[model samples]
Target chain A: MSVTAAFPSRARAWLRGLLAGPLALLTALLTMMGGALWLPEGAAGLDHLVVPVVFFPMLWAGWFLYACLDPRLLRGFAVVGGAALLQLGLILVHLMAAKGAVT
Target chain B: MIKLPKQQTQSLLAVHGWSGVLLGLLLYAVICTGVAAVFAKEISDWSSPLSRPSGQELPTGFDAAYRDLARQVDPLFLHEVFLFPTAGGRWNVLFHVDEKDAKGQPVERGTEFELDPKTLKPLARRDGLLDEIADQRRSNAVADFLVDLHVRLHLPNPWGLLLTGTLGLMMMVAAVSGLFLHRHLFKEIFTLRRRGGLLTARDVHVVAGAWNLPFAFLLAFTGSFFSFATTIGVPAMAMVAFNGDIEAATAALTAKKLPEDPSPVTPANLDALFADARQRGGARVGFVSLEHWGRADARATVQLEAREGGLLNTAYLYSLASGEFIREQPFLGHVPSTGNSLVLLMSPLHFGNFAGVVSKSVWFALGFAGAYVTLTGMLLWTRRRQEQRSWRIMDRAVHLVGYGLPLALAVAPYAYFLLRDRGPHPADTQGVLFLAVAATLIVCAAVADDLTRYRRRLLAATGVALAGLPLARLASGGIGWSAAWQQGLASLLAVELALFVAGALYLRLALRRSATDEATPAAGPAMQA
Candidate 1:
């Protein structure tokens, strides 16, 4: 195979690797953070905090497996990247709103 | 059971093999130590017990002991006090106040006293930080040594937790991928072949791995949760929710706030509260915490062992000033909820202390099998590639660690027993001896040409060390079997017998293997390696 033909396949593999490794980790953590925001605070006022921690392993595994087994590399990147961005946006917005209220 | 395309299956196989090969030794170490750690309480009792068996965890005069100790401590430390039984039922009472250290770090500083269970008199006293108190403890050295290694590998916090957490994830990857890699999972569960060489080794690994899949997943999942909960989960949650105040986050999740009443009042008798908690919870009191001592808002939380035929422990709250029952406390929340229930399940599911000795025995056997699967998996991986020099050396290393770790663990307690009084602190001695044994094994692995002989020698040494432990204990003032039986010290007798039986079995296996291998020089794949 020519070098030009190999470059695209190599780039695709690297992107997939990035998605499966760091991006998957980022998504899992953000989901855990976002869970506390959206989930209900139960009678003890700690459900949101405790539930996400208990299921943290499963959350990470689900994201990691999806990143590895997805056939469409582009689709894999889109989903993981999308989840991370969404959670980050949610957290940032919540922080900004709290800061505004404090001011 | 689960079908996938050929390419995906190949990917799964690659993942499984790589994960196991990369972290299998550390994972094996953790699992092996954990098998022993399942009996940590019993081992502590066996290694360092009082002359007679303990009467009750919380005896009648516990109130007098508390009051006498409280008089010696600073009044500020009366903000919180923790009372529990440890180190063969020696009563430990800590009067502490949560405050910032000189370095501006949050810490609990306190005066701690260890009291004799029978006489209710102080055996030892220390005034300092809680962490320092823990580090200075010598009575439970052997059990603490083994439990610490399993929990954190004895490295510093956060980093040790991170490494073990990552290992837990690697274990989960191997377990999950193994599920996909085996096409005939149910068949393989009963398919151990008696044929010789690499094929037979492969069959044994598969059968053991197949039967232990669910257990491995459960252990790995729960183990990872524990390792990561404080390291990653707590920090991340605190950052978002409490503006990076980990202390505040922890307080919110754990403590139930009561309205402040600063008026001083005479504190109620702790013995009455203990008896009430035991009766109401239908279990023995295991631990007690007093908050705001001698004040109207004072409260006590008494954590009890699991009730009869139950899986989770129950803690009851009480008004310390009034001596009235407040409520049964949930693990995480003020009221029982889904989150609290899930958090409660984690301990019994991970430690297997829910149903007492029977449950612990089951967990120990399954954990032992998990360790076996990991060791065999590594051996088979390296054995297949022994043509390469690196892989051949790896085969030696696998044998070295796989067999050497148990040998080192077995030998560590001898230092604990011998050095408990005359020499250095037994905790430090245990660590030094453990490293010495490991280093010696490493040297042997490096110099020895015959891998099989090295393994057998390690096994024999382990057996001898184990069998001789009871003698060391006896020499260091441990009770003998007849006295133990008469005094109803079943834990001591049981542990002694178990160690002897296990040691004899190991010696028998080693002798039998030496004989069989001498007869046929190149009979098995392990010998070939």
Candidate 2:
């Protein structure tokens, strides 16, 4: 575990961290976009739920991941990350109860 | 083509160059004047004598004064007009009387009267400070010219929107590419070393562009969104999803789904609703919407939400009539989880109209910075290929449009203030001012250029026109600039003074540069080439 040896790995890690941000936002954008053909069928209620049910949770999760991936932004970002997953889970449950497509 | 080791910088330069040229001249007008437009209301008030009194009224009986506003407003228009307890509300209230024409909605004539809220009397108005030099009535003439210019570079509407929208995309692409190209994202943060002439200018473009990338992104994104909402977004959304159901799509985007049921009889008192909203909101009731204003299902809901401390945030709305409070549906805040929240945050983020004075100021500063980034990029673009054969024509076009733009902006406020006294209505004043400024810009674009022979003449003409603004003020018998100032005409005075100062500086620099460039053959080749 020489400091000199660790330097290359640290640089690799930092590079990886920087790339993660854009990747997260991209993933979120894709997930939201993926719901294009996802117009709720029989129940008109599903329509109201489209943005709230599908779009937001992905965006939140993406932003959360984006935040946490930054080492300097690590401290509170982890809590936000955990909350992001929690929110996603809760949103999924809400969507299911509302009879979303995934359900 | 010159090759450089930094592939990314070249890419960024290309992106920056294209985007800048594509939208620069027009956006410069928008930014140059928007620097003043941020304080538009103040500038208007300052330039227009009709809005205020000769002296500030004591606040001792302010509530009584506000109540008096009821008398002046025809009960129907009251909903449209609000009296500021102070000078700082969004806009001043004057009853704009609408005269009906044949088979159409009543045409709004002009501001008929300034209602003294305390007395409810239409005050005997004169063009105060704003008009002492420039017309307050046409204040937006200054801003609107820039806005129209920015969004569409004085091109026709469709063309303007298309160009600006393209520029917006360019801006976004530039930002992304810029971020990608900068390997040392923060290491070069303090790398600005101001050098001679072009290099100094280049450094400025780089530092400002890099440091303000986020702000640039947000401003451009919002700007593009704004222009696109009308030009592209609404149309695209309508065609693709709703089969040109613009109204339905707009309703979804704007209005929270309200019930068809009426809430007339037992509906709560509208006045009481505001008090209740304020009580709930604590700080201020930012928005109030009535579900069924005169109907029974009208549950006046008010939000007791907190200030959104970060981006993509806002949450607060109240019932207009019943003083009943409502929760936001969901999905509004940066932390959107509901419908109510979704709608609430839209405006704040879109307009950057929230978060107190500091936020608005920051938005204003960044907005102009975004505008500068666009302008400097245009200069760099023209300068980059100055040695090429065809570039002379292009350079002339860019510079002609560039320098003349700020002149257009300077002329607009003057147009506004100058025409204010003569126009019967505010609308007429606005119309006259806009027509004058736009006509001038087109004419300038047509005749003006950056010819080495005609350089002094062109700059001198622009400078003279700018300097004439002060003379125009005095010639109009400005109720005396001193009198205008004494009458609490600070806004009018301040803006006019700034305009004059800018005009003087422009004249000085233009004259000096023209003379200096003419004297030295060595400097001549460099500048011209």
Candidate 3:
């Protein structure tokens, strides 16, 4: 029993990972685009198209992604977050200084 | 009790995982952005000094500013311009525009211009106020981008709102599914092992998620309303009860609209009405609309409504000719109305903009925490994996977004002080801040390794930067301690205290990194990076 518990369970873990984050993002974006395209035009131009096109699919996709996270992606999220921060801070000083009064 | 097969359980768990995973990121963005948005006005106020473009002209007085529009703007656009005033803050001029026909739907356009404080000449800039700041920081664009990212990610309007609503639904799904997946929701609420593998990620996800359930739920429900009503709420209501007459349905939801008579004569007494508006509505009489601005046939109308935290979202219309209140549009005031009232309520609750400093501060802190929750979620997710393709890129992005936001936020006020004091002509305060913040985010995004260390560095910097902020105010001719001391320093103290607290929180999080690193040795090494 203990040996069974110790086994990689990589399938479960990987499948679990797929259900979260970027996977959801992809699904939602697709859903929104697809749904928007499907819904009858509200008036014309993009704004009308936007609501149905982007939102529903995204919403549905989120659920789907949660249902699927691709766990590998989860592992990298924070590390990438840290890198993004460093870049953000450096640019902020420049932006803050360039803009004059920052209030 | 019948136990489902393990595979079925895993599938259900997968259902929860996927839906919940995206939620943590999106919700974090929304929460953080929403939090930052709460202090937007205050940040702008703080940063306005830097916004002083190169000019020496005193801010345009309300009367002159009002008269300028009276003379300059076409009569059609002249209901009245709501000047935000330039007392170390961005100037916003808003008036309702006549869209379509007279009996047609009236559209309100909030045209924000960064004015030369010296000349009172309008500055051509977009993204008005906070958005302007975002634009400059280029980081602001990221924020706007994040906002877009958060709510529909710039998918267009109602659909975007609907998308966010669906996201909100997913948030709800994640919340619910999360509960089901976690056998120990309450037990693990505050459990942060900072350990390795799935356990670490699990702790971060459950803890933050559990703690912020209220905020999370509110975010989803209110956010969804933006698109949800048009897509779901309104339609659902119509289908069930109103027979699909959305307009009629909306009218019934709020109070009925009185079709005022078309008086052609422009009003003579805007001053009296404005004074009365202040008296009746208290200080925050935000809305001023002209029933009709142009043509001898048009009557000048001024509509004054309450801002958030005040008594009413209701407005009263005064015909400039008849200065007396024509009639008041009564709002439920904190009470929810099915139609417009619901719309009115959404901004305050979602943005947490409805309260005084204390409430806003509470919201701001929560928002910051929410940002952390997202950062941790991503970190925990990624930490579980030893290696992968594009891991570094994704890791960098998270750091950029997470640390970028606060770094930009802290830098704004500092930038404001330096810039405000510079060049004779005050620069555009909002614009300057945005530019600085953006530049900072990009550079930080490019260089940072372990986002936590970056966060710590930024937090320490922010705390030091803020410590000097109050002193700078003293050195400059801003409201000093003597002046503030008399007024109880309520406003000043409130803002500073909030900033200080925010700095402290960041510092604390940074301090805790070591403990967390012990759990995940890879994380410890990454922290140095």
Docking class of 2: incorrect
Each model's TM-score, in the order given? 0.95, 0.62, 0.60
* DockQ, computed on Cα atoms, for candidate 3: 0.03
Q: Which stretches of candidate 1 lie over 4 Å from their true place?
A: A1-14, B196-199, B514-529
DockQ for all candidate structures vs. native: 0.71, 0.03, 0.03
Candidate 3 local lDDT, B2-86, one digit each (tens): 3445655575565655554555455555556566666554544443332333222223255465556466544545543444443
Q: Residue by residue across B229-324, what tens digits does model 2's lDDT show?
A: 465444533443344666665655555554555434544554555554455445444333334333444444333334445444323344444444
Please give, for residues B1-529, the per-residue lDDT of candidate 1 as tens digits.
Answer: 7899987887788778878998888999999998999999999888888877895478897898789889999999999999888877898988999899789988999999998898899989988889898877888899999999998999999888888887888888889989988989998888866544324667878888999999898888899899999999989999888878898898888878678999999999999999999888889888888999999999999999998789888999999999999998887767888888887888888889988899999999999999989988998788777788788778888888998999999999989887778767788899999999899899989887788778778888889989999999988788888888999998888999999999998888678874534332222344333
Q: What is the TM-score of chain B alone in each candidate?
A: 0.96, 0.68, 0.65
Candidate with best lDDT: 1
DockQ of 1: 0.71
- Cα lDDT, all candidates: 0.86, 0.49, 0.51
Worst 10 residues of 2 chain B by lDDT: B125-134
Ranking by lDDT: 1, 3, 2
Residues A1-103 of candidate 1: C-alpha lDDT, one tens digit per residue: 5323545877867876788889998999999998889999987788899899888888887788778878777778889999999999998898888778879
